[model samples]
Target: MAASWSELMLSKLVGRCNNFFQPGSSRAMCKPFMVGDQQVGWVWPGVEKHIQRFPDVFMVEDKQVSLCPSLQMYEERTARVQEVMVKLREEGEFIALKGWRDEMYEVFHQRSSPPVFRMERTATALLGVKQYGVHVNGYVEHPQKGPLMWIGRRAKNKSTYPGKLDQVTAGGFTAGLTAQEVLVKECAEEANIPQDIALTAQPAGAISYFYEDERGLFPEIQFVFDLKLPLDFQPVNTDGEVSEFYLWDMDKVKEQIAQPDFKPNCAMVVLDFLIRHGHIHPDQEPRYLQFLENLHKTLF
Candidate 1:
């Protein structure tokens, strides 16, 4: 006997939905779904609209089921996919989604956990492990020199990109902290900026960048933020995570970033913010020339 179409689809949906939840151990996290019998980690399921509106967002493989998004819809549908995740929690037959399973595990493990921010990790056998970090490119208006970007020269002793100019304040997001919480804590701990000052800064957005370290550990996501500081703000280094700080003129910063010293995607993200806000003048250099071209196309 063959499976009905709806039955097959439902099974696939359940499988993909279960993949979202996994257990976190002390050393590493456990992934829910297996890829060719090997567990894979968390994957962002595009946006909510595609999950609800597009038929192809869900798929099945070998009756053992594997799911992935259609390439055309992946970028535009991220938020939409996340929004409908709760629906799967309610309707799917996956053990992870069942409240009883989580409750039983909590009781058995003697740990209290929350739903939205649960920890998950990739399979242990993978050569490289990725971790998430937050970076803030802070800017303040200078009374005499216009807008200045805050930057830090990383310490030479650092394990990764050492002695290079980097974001003003950056740190790993520890357990039980939101991005906002991490940013505030990082600002104080790394740059000696007050928690109130960091908290008050507006969140521009996030950009994810990936890179690999010398040891084969992939520090995949640097979640970037643009923070506006007061004109009179002066930061002191509290923890020496940053060796030194400088307020660079926009042009100089852009020029320095274009060189090989700066981290690739991090520099580009800051340049994107500057170009979008018209701070980097079109007449300045080739970088701004491209920005102007993009702006013209965007406008007309």
Candidate 2:
């Protein structure tokens, strides 16, 4: 019995997703990024070398990379980090710094606690810091054809994941904003979804993963939302971030996600949706439990 395309694709997606969760070896190699006793992030080898230059601001030891304990104030710590990031950007020390937007991301020891400091958005991944984003699964339930999803094709001009398929609307959770706030903003900016309609989106929990590549480490959490649109509603790309949009049936979506064209993270969002909507059943999927476990990995 040869494996069906759906079976093969599901297996492949699970394997790809597994890669993000298996950061045991890489995590061991990276130094803990600490503030006082709390480990906020991980410092990659290259970033560790650069932070070593600023001994006054960063106290780099063999076991860990830490912000100087003397800098107690949040503003002081933020300014000090920004100074180092600016210097690195000026000297072209890191490829990630090249895309330095003025955007900031607040870094916290724990999600519920106050931020220790804020840093440039792009530098977060380079430091192996945890990043949060919102991904909305916009779909319409047709009476005859069943549920169809609205998928966005990222614009070619975008710095990352250009020309790839993505969620209908998505955006990073920036400094001082809640996940719901981001969802509303992204809904309008990315897909022209009205605020009233966007507000109706149900919170679908979250999925997290940790992965390392040549650029650096990614400890990412995507806060997922599900919005069922009216049968006649269509998503328009207001922001140039998305070039086009497609309304795909579940089978087509499954096939597309199995291919390289779809963004990996967004594919996970879709997979989670399928499972929650009873599209992917436990009786049918051999690795059902494993898939559920892989979707939500612990990351601090």
Candidate 3:
């Protein structure tokens, strides 16, 4: 028998996710690079050349090159690292990445509830560092039509994923906010969701993946969420970050997702929603058991 579109969608999403970790030891590549007990950030083994390129900030050895241990003496060495990163940008080293956001992302040795230290957000991926992000899958249950999902098309002028499909609410986990705080704030800013409604979102499990592309290695964590909006409530794009809003029925959503319309990472968030809501059942998917196991599995 031929597989259903839903089946293919689920399988492809899982396979694409696993490919990130399958190339090398998934766990090996995602290992935290530390000094003594302190985990400064993630470092890929093969990135010694890149690290060596900046000798002052990165102390390069034969096999490993890490930030100087003395950098720990300061409150945050991100300013020093930012200097090197800025020089690289000036020399045309970084392409396709945006300018500095003036926002700092926490670098952790472990996935601490509150991360370890603040680093310039722009440089983390360039340095093969792991970072945290939150994705909330906004949805509504119709009395007769089952569940419909809220999707956003990103603003064309945005630097990353411009004009691509995104979740209802998604943003990087910055230095000062908790996961829940980010969820609520992004919901309001991106979708005009009220605090009471956004607070109703349930904490779904998370997904972890690492991929290396022309840009750099992105070791990412997406904290998932499931939110059910009231039947009459319509999502409004308030911040202008999103160009439009889409309310797709389950079947239409499956078909739309089968195409390449959605952003790469946001697809995983939707797939997780489908599985948890029983849209994709065990018998419907060949990789059902494997996908279940991998969803919450962490490289960290």
Candidate 4:
């Protein structure tokens, strides 16, 4: 029998979620990247061979990768790592480093503890380190139509996910910024939203997944936010990252996410929104429980 549209959508959403969490046998082949006895990330064989050249900076042995113990201080370690990263970047070694933004991300054993060192944001992925980001789900309560969400289309020129659908406002969490700081900055920079309006965005928890691709391993967490925008408000892209915005009803948003155009991670964020707001209920969706559980995988 042909599956109904609702059933098909649920199946697709679950499939997408499953894909993001599947690291497969690739993870077993990579070496755990460690610093001060704590594993901070993973080192792929290709990157591992290159870093092995810098013996003064890295120590790869015993089926694991670690920074040289002599580089003890945080600054010292970060500087040494940066030097190796620069050499790799100049050589155009990894595809992940090509779009380097000059932004940095901290390397931590866990989210609560202090970072051991920092590395270029792009390299974090190449090394299989977890990345963090903020995603805002902007919506309005229409007097007549109920709730409507604001979605963005990535600019065609974007280096990644060009012309794909994404959240209303999103930005990666860099080395020194807090989640709220990234949230407010992205709201204004991506959507031209003012600070006062952006401040009202409430914390909407987070979603995490461990996904791998040709670029590298992505064990990522996106801190989510919900912004209740005024009915008359419109989002204009200040940055070229986003090409356009759409005010979509819940059904429309659901339908589009089922297709391939929506960025995978962003689709998970929207699915989280729908589940939290009752747009998708346990009574109707057979995969409701599984979706809630798998969307927030424990990467560590």
Compared with the true structure, what per-residue lDDT tens digits does model 1 show for residues 16-134?
Answer: 21111213211122122222233222222222222334344333333222224442332333333333344554655323333222210000011133321122222111212234567
> If the candidates were sorted by their TM-score against the true structure, best first, what order would they fall in?
2, 4, 3, 1
Give the distance in Å from residue 24's predicted Cα in candidate 2 to where it truly belongs. 9.3
Deviation from truth (RMSD, Å), model 3: 3.1
RMSD of each: 17.4, 2.0, 3.1, 2.1
Worst 10 residues of 2 by lDDT: 1-10
Encode model 4's per-residue lDDT on 104-212: one tens digit a residue. 9988888898888899998897778889999999999999999999999999999888999999999998889999899889999899999999999999899987777
Residue runs of model 4 more than 4 Å from their true location after superposition: 1-25
Q: After superposition, how far is residue 21 of candidate 4 from its true place, in Å?
A: 5.0
Which residues of candidate 3, in runs, are more than 4 Å off?
1-18, 22-32, 37-47, 96-99
User: Which digits, one per residue and each the tens of the lDDT, describe model 2 over residues 1-300?
Assistant: 113645655554445544544545466678888999999888977888888999989999989989999999999999998999899899997878888889999898888889999999998877788988999999999999999999999999998878999999999988999988999999999999999999999998998876666567788889999999999998898878999999999988977876788888888899899889998888877767766776787876
Return the TM-score for each candidate structure: 0.53, 0.94, 0.86, 0.94
Candidate 3 residue 72 Cα shift, in angstroms, is 1.9
Cα lDDT, all candidates: 0.48, 0.85, 0.72, 0.85
Give stretches of model 1 more than 4 Å off: 1-130, 217-219, 280-300
Over all chains combined, what TM-score does candidate 3 have? 0.86
